[model samples]
Target: MSAGVVTRLSTLDRFLPVWILAAMLLGLGAGHVIPGLGAAIDAVQVDGISLPIALGLLIMMYPVLAKVRYDRLDTVTRDRRLLLPSLLLNWVIGPALMFALAWLLLPDLPAYRTGLIIVGLARCIAMVIIWNDLACGDREAAAVLVAVNSVFQVIAFGALGWFYLSVLPGWLGLPQADLAVSGWAIARSVLIFLGIPLLAGYLSRRLGERARGRDWYEARFLPRVGPLALYGLLFTIVVLFALQGAQITGRPLDVARIALPLLAYFALMWTGSFALGRGLGLSYERTTTLAFTAAGNNFELAIAVAIATFGVTSAQALAGVVGPLIEVPALVALVYAALGARRLFSPHVSGSDRVRQA
Candidate 1:
């Protein structure tokens, strides 16, 4: 039997794209039609970070982190077949691929190109979980991988930002782009946006489980807080698009341009990872986890960094915002693609069985 994971989503999740689109339009309209709205939003800042936007980002990250079974990380670490390939895909190949695509596709638009590279550097620590689960992937693997990503994101994101944006391009004889923000600045943004949520989620999971046990934590507590991720995501998008509404509306083709490379990146990454996993003899469920996790970008951290580094109205921020606009639907479609590709694996490897075990 198939996992039927996608069928289990609540109504709000089923029509997520619609709600996001509506939020985008609403923000854009409010920004364009209403004067000073963006300013009003920007005026409220804590330590130079927009308060509302910061809140939304924190909310977006927390529940997803909370859902991770950090305890299972030891198990994942022992599985070098899975862990090694995932590290190579996420940190090395993923960033290099995006850098190449950004330069090739958006050489002229340095701002957006750098923005895309930043997206690549910020690996998915949030929504990949849902995509993995929906694709009937290994749940333990997904949680552990995401936790690994969060840790790597903290330690390496700034350095990768520097390498891709400033160092590597010069080495390749391409026009070197300035990241503008210092490494410390990028680190600060990642720390605030990711670190806070990471600690909160870790603590929540630990304390919640200790107090009421794992069953209540996962079944009762998680379901309540889980939706907050998307809610925070939508809220942040509205605020972001609101700030950049005029610019986004003015340059429709630019958004499309940013999207094309992202589309290529996702397709290439997912397919490549899937093939790699199957060739490595991973089960269908593990392969699906590997593919989705590899394919997904952490747009929450991307947007936060873009906005924190470059103001919300900048083209860089716009590129970061377009990430989820494309990723949500793209990855959702890939979920189905993964489900169909299940037959390609050995008949002995059952996805439903793996899901049940996870």
Candidate 2:
């Protein structure tokens, strides 16, 4: 990369928080100014998947996946130690933490509690890359973890949701009844949001390289196409806030009530991820990647599943909307925190070396 481009990229990274907040304000303002705008856009869905959300996810995820070194995937498997921690954190610890937090924090708000847990269950697929990038995380590791999480989300989300949302509530003596969500329903959302983008990113990277050359593809194509993901993220943020702006505006206190547990979840997960990575003596890059992969939530899939099972008007879906409203800013802050704390973690190592050590 050219010196100028490197400088520009750093500048972009630093300003990401500002841009995201601006998008939120603009989206909220536009939603209030133009009545029914959010509803009109949100109503455009196919098979329980919102088309705009799907598109935004596609744009956000493709570049990140495209950058993955597919050849290095084998190395990831061979050195399986680093992968286990993140898997445990993502699937086991993360979901359990959210479930506990939801019930503990929102005892009376069952639908909202369900929504928060759903967010936890739907690990990162789309925006994981942005957080990883912002934190200067190991890109290859992030890709591998994201792919793994996507697969797990498909198989586990429905059952876990049933276990937590239904069985747990009744088990805890809550009045909420058990609701069974079809596993395939959750799978459909994953396929639309994650599966397609994974395939397209792989194909686009391969074909573009074959057609043009490695040097041009890496230098020209990557730089040009990379920022599109951020744009897509900004667009997603706008739409999300636009959709839920009025509700948020009307009941700001309620929004704050819903946000409390989510904020706690992010902070706790990031800290634990960092400590675990360091305890295992992983490199700074891999450590940050693990932190983000575990910390970030796939709000799109969560929102889709929420609406499909709970109805568009349900508080469950509204809680799903609140996911991005809180997550974007929280993750942005964590990104900066990770970058600043990078030096404290310890000796930087190459990806291969880090994988081997972990």
Candidate 3:
């Protein structure tokens, strides 16, 4: 890539989250004043699914998947310590904590609380890449983690859904849970969202490798797709937030309440995973990469499933939508924090050290 292209890519990487948040606010404001705009946009459904929103998410997930180096799966699998922490944080600890927080804080709003759990359970799909890059993480390891998480999510979503409804309530001091999420519905959503993008990305990569050189593929195609993916994600967030603008205005405090647990979750996961990776004697990059992989959530999939399982008007779906609103900004901050802390921990000679030693 040319210096200018590389510079532009870096700039976009820095500010994409800000742009997403701006799009969401702008869309929400417009939807509120325009009254029926959100409804009309949301009404553009196909086969009982929101076509525009779904397309946006699909487009958003494409770039992340496109970067997956499937051949490196063996290398990642060999790192059992990294994989174990990721599984525990994402599947065991993350989901459990989210359920407890949702139930405790949103006692009266079952749908919203349920939506939060759904989002948490879905795990990281896209933003992990951005965070991993920001933290200067192991690129190959991050790619393999993404692929593994995608595969596991498809297989475990149904079982997780069942556990969320059947088992989570008792642990949280709540009454019997009665949420009805069909296994088939979870399976279909996973297949349509996660499976399609993964296959498409894999096929595209394979074809690009055959047709064009790796240099051309990375420099020409990958760079182009990265920003497009972020744009697509932001656009979807805009539409979803717009659709629920009125509710957000009415329950502004609700955002704060939900954000508390999310913040806690992020901090705990990031710290725990980072410490674990460090104790295992992994490099700084691998540690941060694994930390972010464990910390981020695939909110897009969560929102999609929430809307499908519970009506778009339901607070559950709205809660799922709200996650990205808080997370985009929070994660951006975490990205910078991770990057800034690198010099302090990295064994590689710091620039200042080199200058002083010189």
The clash number for model 2 is 0
Candidate 1: residue 123 lDDT (0-100): 90
**Tens digit of per-residue lDDT, candidate 2, span 126-179:** 788878875667877877888788788878887787777777778778765455
Q: Write the per-residue lDDT of candidate 3 for residues 29-76, one digit (tens) a residue.
A: 977899798788878987556787778778877776777666666777
Residue 307, model 1: lDDT of 81
**Candidate maximizing lDDT:** 1
Better of 2 and 3 by TM-score: 2
Give the runs in model 2 whose Cα sits over 4 Å from its true position.
Answer: 1-9, 171-176, 345-358
- lDDT against true structure, model 1: 0.81
TM-score of 3: 0.83
Per-residue error for 54 in candidate 1, Å, reads 2.8
Q: Which ranges of candidate 3 are over 4 A from the true structure?
A: 1-9, 104-111, 133-135, 171-173, 304-310, 344-358
lDDT of each: 0.81, 0.79, 0.72
Model 3: clashing residue pairs? 111-316, 123-298
Rank order by lDDT, top first? 1, 2, 3
| True lDDT of residue 40, candidate 1 | 91
For candidate 1, lDDT tens digit of each residue in 147-219?
6887787778877888887788888888776654555655566577767887998899999999999989987
